[model samples]
Target: MKKNLLWLVVFCFSISAFGQAPKHTFKLGESDFLLDGKPFQIISGELHYPRVPKEAWRERMKMAKAMGLNTIGTYVFWNLHEPQKGKFDFSGNNNIAEFVKIAQQEGLWVILRPSPYVCAEWEFGGYPYWLQNEKGLVVRSTEKQYLEEYKKYIIEVGKQLAPLQINHGGNIIMVQVENEYGSYAADKNYLDINRKMFIEAGFDGLLYTCDPAADVKDGHLAGLLPAVNGIDNPAKIRKLVNENHDGKGPYFIAEWYPAWFDWWGTAHHTVPAEQYTKKLDSVLAAGISINMYMFHGGTTRDFMNGANYKDISPYEPQTSSYDYDAPLNEAGNATEKFRQFRSVIEKHLPAGQSLPAIPAAKPSMAIAPFKLNEQVALFNMLPQAVKNATPLTFEDLKQDYGYVLYRTTIKGGKQGELQLKQLRDYAIIFINQKRAGILDRRLNQNTLSLTLPEGDVQLDIFVENMGRVNFGKYLLENKKGITEQVTFAGTEVKNWSMYGFPFKNINSYTTKPSAIQGNGPTLQKGTFKINTVADTYLDMTDWGKGVVWVNGHNLGKYWAIGPQQTLYIPKEWLKKGNNDVAVLELLKNDQQILKAIDQPILNTLKKINVE
Candidate 1:
């Protein structure tokens, strides 16, 4: 009874605004959105709930409302909500219903983009990693298994959100079909089924599909409203949309990219404020409905960060701070571009309409450098081994995030190209628990030549899921670790033991007195006292690349080779007393410490090309 009570309390607070379903009437016309026989142009801004802290959801919404936005668009991350198959989570910030309720309460409409395959550079394009394990399963296709799972997921989402839609007296005005489908494939059967499933799941309001202006022909489906993305020239965009869909109007630019997202080692992307204002002016003058792709781009945080891979480039994993170089900076602070865009928005409002005053920026403070004195080793906290003669994928072991260690006794050590077939991302190769060399999939550096001492050599290869490919055809094969057999001297050594170090129980890491002297990954722990708790950015300048957890909350990843070197630690996670801080440093295992900085270091462009 006590456990059940705890579960309910957690569920309720996580999605704090969850409530009873109510109904209204919302419909779509050829030229405009109608709210009870009136023309309504949806001026929206996209903001993912998972990316923002749950406690600040209302504040962000208020900011959006203040910025002249009538709608808040978001995508439902499948893996974030349902990490494991069969089991589902609609709790806390994961709860779209709660998020929508907050939007509604803030006098903002909702544009729910529940893309099961949301390729917003998210891991596996928002598909759960477990789906890869399903036998002969093909996602974003007409495959029965894929559809079945998609059906279950969409239906579950609908049960929670359909009632809250504007048609049902709630704030949600539009429901997006499979996100940007035109870019992925052009399967009418697949889209037809998707439309059927969404309705069956109970989304009885306006349903539409969005795609890049070029891909509209391939991705747009019949019986669904089609919208073009990223294009600013309203006339050209509409021309492109209509040429593909027989010229339907009341134009909507689904994802207007004011700026782009950041990847590790790349300079933070930004477009001049003048560029955005010019495009936005033309768009509003043409009377087009628009949703800024990310009016407020928040942090992706942790392993949830996704990657991009096309045959044209290397595997590019996104940085933790999704700042997007958007008008709203990483810390949710406004920039010069914000004011410029606000002026443009003010000019476009209807004769009698006006925007609310922009909210004041949130406060931040700097903390004195704190030392990470305690040490915890990964080797000490691993769970029981998933013994296997060969190797296994992350999905095969039913694991999602964190590092995986493949241990084996390399007999009569030989020197040659130690190759890993399709190594998912990055690997730290160790011979007898010491660093040998690194193998990264991004640079096509898959094999490392090593000189091994000839006794019974204990070979351990530690692989990090740099992040799964969220976009492109390579997504089908994003299984981490030495996926196939490791070859030494072009021979397959059989009968090896594999350890699954998924770090499922991160809190259980072994803490003991140790002469921490290895270059391998080290867990540095520390404690800091705080008389008052508030939001802070864990400055990663003093330390190297690693993940940080404060008071047991996974703050996210940090790399020295970064455009993003600070992780946002929300006040909700901090305490009034001493707060525990842990760092899992993978690059340099120096006994370094961290401090809290008032500002985030998001755009420190390191010029060394990652590829």
Candidate 2:
């Protein structure tokens, strides 16, 4: 009881020192944002709660406060909250309400971007994969089934966070309606439905919509404030906001990109601090509100990283590490850009006031290489196969993510081109239990030469859902695995057996590794002891393509196709004793050893299969 009293005392003291009243008002005025009826300039930074672990949310917020930011911006991912239909999870790292309350305790207000359709390079644009099962459901539209699911999700979010709004004695100052709807379509009716949903969910604070500069006019609602994204020109920002927002003057850059995200085959993107700090200074000089798209881009853990595709570009899957080269690195350590931006922001602070002290960098360690002695072949542990006349997609099998195997027998002596119609993503072909080429959707690889033997040969096509396209027009039909038929020698192959490997229970299948062998997917296990635990990167430089699990915590996917060579393992997932490591390598593993390195190799590249 005494501990509770002391904790309350510290919380009240922090709130008082931050000049936060129990109740406050935030609204858009004719020429400025009125906080307590006074002109207020929002100095904010973006940090997604799902990206960072729950244990480290407060430290990341402290980093934001130390960087002279007065506000925190976050996007609530629909998929992360509701992985299944009618079932929701707001606990653990998914606890966005706790995230916002922590921001308040850390002396920062919040700009909640709780749009159902968030395109942050997240899987399926933050839409739950189960939505694909809802036939005739068109996302970002006023479609009945889509809206019904959306309303349920948003109301749950509202129940968790709406009461936390600044008007309700909480810290959320503004809420975004829809995310970049103008870039997708020009339907105000669709956006209005989203607005009504937010309002009905009890989000009565200042409502706004954010879109790119070119799409600002198409996306913003007439009754709500419209915030421009991507552009930082002080004059153009004011001009665009005034033109679209009824000659108003509370100019805000909702997504000021200091750097860009990295795709699988591309080089890591970085923008020099000198390049954007100047623009940041100018934006602040004009007294415009700004939210740095990512003050700290944390790791996109698990299989949740997204992909991108359009009419012009090939299917490009995002790298697992979301270290956006921001002021803070993926581990929440301050970068040189952080210091440079802090210097620029210090000049704009009220006289005699100073930012909080920058926190010390988190400690990281390196572990000696360890061998994965035990192994289990994927084929040896296949679940009961579902038989079908034609190959089925991931959704058809009720599988959300991971790999699926399509097996059948093809007559011999007919060696010709083998093809998979509408291959969702990556696939590995095997004939008579021997590896026979690969097919990658990113490279539009669908056909390969096949040489059948004398007898009827067993055919196996293992397909993996690398990730769903989270942006552009192609996202509408992103059904993973073999979406269509398989043909050999121009004849449709039939009588297939489908096996799903969602890997939900990695331990159930891997508790006792076997002496399995073959050129198929293999689950390998390794163990290492640590004197102390800290943040580290599992070096996958020697491995091929697959996922890694440290103490059963998935570190996301890694491939030899260049760019991302290491998987980040947070210290919170580590302990001070023996830790188990598992790897599910799909292609090849010549060396059965792995390393826990201290540094990241995000920019390294191997031979990329695609042009």
Candidate 3:
């Protein structure tokens, strides 16, 4: 009887211990973060799980925690979760649940910022491209169509994360409403709708909106907490919080800009570690909660890269390497800035807590060059029926991204001005399967004069969708593959064959002997072998502008100028032996040989003066 009583007592204790949720909350004017009504100070860092690969998520989070961050803040990218309008993807790296679960396992609290407009310098500021395709979709505004779509996205996200809130026995403490709404416009309805959507979806946790101090008033939603972002001055933060949130407590630096993003043509950006560390010290001294803009910046990957627009200049596309020069680099390895910030953070901790040791960095291996030998002529691979129809857009054929081929036969020899009417960005023109000339939309030059052959002249044009225009008033004009008319020597060509090659089926292209070549506009194949793995850049200077793929991974576009010259080939993507590489150089001259060099970022190519 005594033994049975003891067993019951033990069972009760175990249940009580395991069933209780970690006590956490945020109350305004509280000098310390509150945990079950007690004061606590949160040292946090922002790193989105979706941005980093799933395999590397935990390691990055662990690194953040080791840097003295008690909280792991992440912005849930709506576009990544739902690429299509209705279709959703929550598996793999899109698994926000697993990411949150892992954070809890690491004994870290989570700050969920499911912004419909994250603007993390991500494509369209994290808004899906398909949203732009929606007629009359005014993003971040109170437009009816935009609101309806935003509400649906919020509801869907809430279904996945609402239950994980602190109130529901999960680690998620605060859920941010719309991101920086006031900075763009004073849309009260838009802000309110987003907040209500969260509540409607059952996210009953502490709700808040983050905005710069100047825009706080316009961004604040009723019945929700208001946090300030991008405030370097602690005194200003206090005043802004007091003015915006009733002069209360529990203030936060929602986004401290530790580093900035770099565009394709611009040189790599770097801010001295001392400046960031000093600002961080001040914030810590004030005992305010803060999250770094990007504790770690990861790759944009594939065609998900975005563009920045300046009214005076042409559209500037962001590079694939989102190495924002943060405390953590794009590869998830800690930077010198990371260490300096870590030391500063450690000094400000409430005296009792200690930081964990940083984990060992991922090791990289050097790899030898691998050659590919198989070549297939793109002109010969066209389907039989495109002969009778006009050239169609990517939408007409149900294709999404990558290179598309347009082919036709001109009876007249090449001697007149060739103009691609409204060429959607870029095109490589070929006559008789030989490189004739190149036209780039960046230069706003779509006309070229080519030497045409008289007998059965075949014309081939390869067009690459080099990232859809991601932002602003001009987004409506982002349709791919010849949106306007195509004129050769002032004559409209009829009956052209269109081939949609999105690069998704890159593996399907059969490998053939390097010598199996054809006539004009023929696809040539070759292979090189590599024995060891190292970070290297494939010099595309010799080849006319085109896309290159190594081991089936699209290495982005390469041109022979002052723009993105060397695509970063991370050691992670390289194999020790026989790695495959294929190039679709549109205007290949006789000197089209690819050379690999050790470097990831490129800036030495000849820059075209856009003036």
Candidate 4:
């Protein structure tokens, strides 16, 4: 018990001695957060640095401040920082320091939830795709390769924000370890190592672990406080936290979700602001700290978007507009939910404190439908194919997102069942350059039966990387495109030429006066001129499935079957005068023209049958 007493002495001394002066001490007490030697409350809201544009960062912070939120909780996405493993990019939009400093300037405290394995519905749960290429590497486990690589990543992050922790007089008060790991595994050794790594990374602030209340025992580490997520019954959540923390206090709801996310073919989610505001009221009234899961859910642009399941549960690709139906809409406008939430927050504010006025919404305008007059067929843009005996997965070619093409020559004839074993996501079949059929994993489709003319028929399969699984134990198998070999009936097809279409690397794609060929994928280009550009959404309601690019900046995918038909085009990506727009339509039907609209079509979930 002497050792325990010594630790208690150090803890009490740290709380007291560290509490005096400009360098504020944020310590976890028996039942409260002692900020500068007094009980403190953290009224925080979740926001992501990458989701919001670098230009609009200040405005979003202002919106959070106006909503009566005192703290901003954000997760540092790992995959974004280290896109191509070992090659890190913390400059420009990738800079998380600038985002934190901006929040501090806005008079808001910060809670840094740096989940290296963040499962925020992000691509590969924020894991770099290159990790899959590592020999014998397994993520989110006690594997040696994963731990070594994970340490390097966290150390890089520590270099940027270690000095910003609250103990160093910065706004960051609390830092999280791994995210929701108990939901996936029960490895206490992994949890212990993660805790040790965070400390080694120079995060001297109060550290904690968050998991669903049901899984607290497996997720929470000893000596560190435990926080619960998705808990509505305040008493039950608090009980779980106390049980995990040896009946200690500082009851906190790490993610009291007020809204939900959407999938590609699923309906958008929303709860009447009245329903959740009441729960917030009760939670706060009971003296429990809370963070609104997402006060302003923004967009997930380009190939950065992640998927849910592959060949299971309809291949749910998370939509671009992460607009989790929060208080602030995708365009940063104050919704009715904002007003109701503000009132509820005001009711629970400290006596003599007041909230700032809600900021005015940004301007939005609509433009006429611009025709994609120029065209380029998929077959015409092919580079020298990489000869392979069988199909290669995206990881095999070191390609993360976009499409891959496989082609072979049929000797006798092409009238048989073309079966693809372990198809990743989506694919289109062709025989002698003629569109045969589609094989979608959403409907569990793997075989395509077609008839082709006799003699040396060219068989092609263009596979698209819809997205990789962002969540679940199935993440280990998230290799995109065709994973295994293709078969003609019971026979394995060999001697194939493969092509990789990693769209991000392409600088300039040429268009020609070409006729639409063989019912295949096409690249259509259009031009729009603007005197002074403003933020607008590109309407893709009339379009089939494809990705859209504006002046070379990828605006992300769109489909006529809705939920999200309009893509948010940030003003920063636009310029004065003529701008080029390109669309890569995989299954073109009626969408020939793109419309610049005043608003987003995020809620339009149209009925689509992939089968």
Candidate 5:
């Protein structure tokens, strides 16, 4: 009997210690979130995986935890995952599941927001560029084509994340359906479809929809929880959630903005940390859950940055640096705001619990000035031209992003007002290999005078797809390059030779040595060495508008037009020895010497002639 009893005690202890792990249940309650039947408050911060390097995800999450945040939020970019239809990339920086796993490892819960149409200033509102080629397709709606494509992508995401939910023994507690849909349109049917898709994709956890406080009624579905964004009044947030959620509770403030994103020509948006601490304190004191929009706004690298356009606001393309002046700066350093917010959060922490120590800032260094003297003209490296009677848009030619050159032979006898009908963004026109003038869509100026010579001249119009609109009704018609026809002297110019410069691989062209001549787009190349690799910023003060690449990695676009004058170079992309550098300068560059500095110059602005 004694031997049997001893085995029984050991067996009971084993069952308590290492038997099947108990499943956690997270659900919305009358006035609070219940975790395993106990009321829980989520203190979350938003950090995008694509924006931050995958190598730095764990460090950023550590920073968030040190700031007293218990949860981490992120938007899984669709375009980043599936740049082309039927092709998916989930490796390296695109490994979102790894990001979530890191958050869980840091003892932080995750709020999975794998919305199909996330408008986080991403390219095309996170819709793959190939969607434009689909006929009669409407995104963020009940269009059959859109729904079919969205289902495939979302289901794939579910396969990766569904098993990680709280009930399945992971830290993911909630999954958001659609991102700010009510701000775009009031399509209840479309929102419903999105909800069903998430459920069918094996997302059996609690689901929610987030929108501006005013548009919650339009975006919120019947069964899911309604989360308010933008506004942060304790009473107002509670009232909005109650009103939309059938007078129930468990209110969530999805996106409480501490600062705003900066556009190319505008001033960097900054919000004083002290200005919002009072509101943040009141919200937490009232026992409401909150998620800061950007605890650390990382870089919007490459050509992935989006633009803003509407009837009231002029066309404004967002800067590549997505440093939203949050608690953690773009380089992931804790700022004064970080200290202020931590003090405020300390006041709300439970007894006997304290925030973790803030992690040390990453190392940074400055490099001596370097020169890019080797030159090659952009026209010398054109791909095989696609002959078309009419000019083709970036989408029509099956080319997404980058520049497209439209060339045609025109009679030189008559010269009048030359106009490009509905030019997508920016264009530089040349006549017989000589520059004529430039037209910018941002200023809504597309007409310029042309002087035709005696004989037939090659008229080339170089158009750049600056960025696609990420929000509002304008996103539906957002296509790159010439969307319509080009006219010289009010006459339609036909029989065009279109050349697409996707620049997916420029190694072949950048190596072909050719002497630079005239004031046309040129490719400049050089090399530099660093003793120790560290995060730095490339100063673009003297260069004209163009894209820059280091060691073959695209560093994104840089223009002389004010606001952003430097490009951030993450340490992960740099090496200790020699590094190859190249720049595709769109305009003329008087001086091609560049320098790497330790700090970012995000506020510097230059005078632009839009006239």
Candidate 6:
């Protein structure tokens, strides 16, 4: 009888342990975040799931919990979820549903910001690049086309996540409606329409709009919660919330900047650890809820980097690495800032509620250099030409990114200056597949003179869309793949055959001889071998300008220009056995030898050429 009693007691304890919910809820007016329902203040950390690997999601969440955070906040990138217009991708790293489920499993509540425009320094501010093609399509506005597309995206995202809200037994307590709209423009109609769409999509949870405290009046959604983002002063934050919400409620810092992000030409930015700690302490001491802008900032990866606008002359593009100098760097390892923030948070936690111990850092691999054995010539891979073709944009072909080739044969040797009336960004001109010259739109001139040998001369011009102009007043001017007329000796070249070569299809091309029968710059192919795997950077400082790929992953564009010298190759992508590397160098006739090294920052090519 005593043994039976002991078994019953053991079973009861097990049930109690396993049945407890990971999150607690707090109530405000009518809205609730039920963390045991006792007015729990969430010290949350923000990290994008798509930016970090799926395997590392748990570890990062654990890190946030260990740092005394009760919640994890993430922005759902629309571009990532819907790469094309109507199609949606939620599998692989794009699996945001699974990411939320994992955060719940790790015993943390979630704050979701499903911004169709998440300005997380992502490409096109999370809007798909294809949207640029729709004529007169004004983004974030009340335009019918923009609204139609935006509504579809939000509805699709809602279909995936609406069932997971706290009301439906999920950990998502709050969903944000359109990020920081007031700061950009005073379009209340746009904000209201977005909020109404979210409601229409069945997101029944509490809705909020976050903006700078000053812009709260302009950006805040009427009848919903208004949260302040980037407000360092606690007293002002409290005052603003009370003034806006009518007397009393919880004040939250939606985006607290722990560190800053750096561009290519600029110096690496680092915030003083002491100042950040003191600011964080002030917020916590007030018993206010705060979420760090990036508890851990991960890599942007591939061609996903965005550009920032300058009202002045030079427009600068952001780097591929989204390493925002955050408490945790791009690689997911905790920095000195991480430890300092943890200590401060631990000091402010309620008594007896000790934070979990930090987990040991994950092991990193050392990658070795590898050779690209198989070589396929770019010229040989051209598709059957579109005879007598009209100039077509990327949307016309239903293609997204990468190079396009326009080939045509001329009758006579053209002596007068040739000009591309409207060259989009950058292009390479070749006579009979031989390098003739280059036309760059940054200089705003495509005039070049070349001696063409007579009799059925083959003219091939290769053009690359070096990322559309992402921001500023000039964003409307962004278009790619020969936006203007091509003229030979001031005569318009009408008959042409255009071939679209999106780099994603590189693996499908068969090997062929890379011989230059005619001649400007010859397409050359070579391979280097690697026995072991280690993280290394390919020094592209010596090569003219082109794209490089390792094991099919586009490592981003590299040029001999001043700023970005080496492309970062994470060790996780490399294998111990033979790894393939390919380079499509635009300028030829130079001795090309690429060396790989152990570290990324220091392994740039020795010769730095600016001219």
Task: Give the TM-scores of the predictions, in the order they appear.
Answer: 0.93, 0.95, 0.83, 0.93, 0.95, 0.83
TM-score of 1: 0.93
Q: Rate the local accuracy (lDDT) of all candidates.
A: 0.80, 0.89, 0.72, 0.83, 0.87, 0.72
lDDT of 5 by residue, 94-160 (tens): 8888888899899999998998888888888888899989999988878899999999999888877
Q: Name the weakest run of 10 consecutive residues (lDDT summed) in model 5.
A: 14-23
**Local distance difference test, candidate 1:** 0.80
lDDT of 6 at 488: 77
In candidate 5, how many Å is residue 389 off?
Answer: 0.6
Count of clashing pairs, candidate 2 = 0
- The runs of at least 3 residues in candidate 2 whose Cα sits more than 4 Å from the true structure, single-residue gaps closed, are 1-22, 511-514, 608-611
RMSD value for candidate 2:
5.2
Model 6 C-alpha lDDT per residue in residues 1-611, reported as the tens digit of each score: 99999998887774453343323443564222335556567788888887776777887888888877888899888878888878899998899989998998988888999968877777667778778767778887899999999988998888778766765567888899988887777788888898899988867777888998779988886677788998878899878777777666578889998787755555556787788898999888877889898887776665676666555644455555566777776666667888899999989988888978777654444333433334445676577655555566665666666777887877765586777776665678887776777776654558888788978888888887665555444545656777777887877887778887776734555554444344333234445555655455676656676667777766666655425566666556677655666676666434346666443341122334322
Model 3 bad stretches (over 4 Å): 1-23, 30-33, 383-392, 408-422, 449-459, 475-477, 488-496, 516-599, 602-611
Which regions of candidate 6 deviate over 4 angstroms?
Answer: 1-26, 29-36, 133-136, 247-249, 360-370, 386-390, 408-423, 431-459, 471-477, 486-493, 512-550, 560-566, 570-572, 587-596, 602-611
Q: Tens-digit lDDT track for model 4 on 180-291?
A: 8788888888898998899888887799988888788888888888888998677897789888888888988999888888777667788888888788888878878888
What's the C-alpha lDDT at position 370 in model 6?
Answer: 39
What does candidate 2 score on TM? 0.95
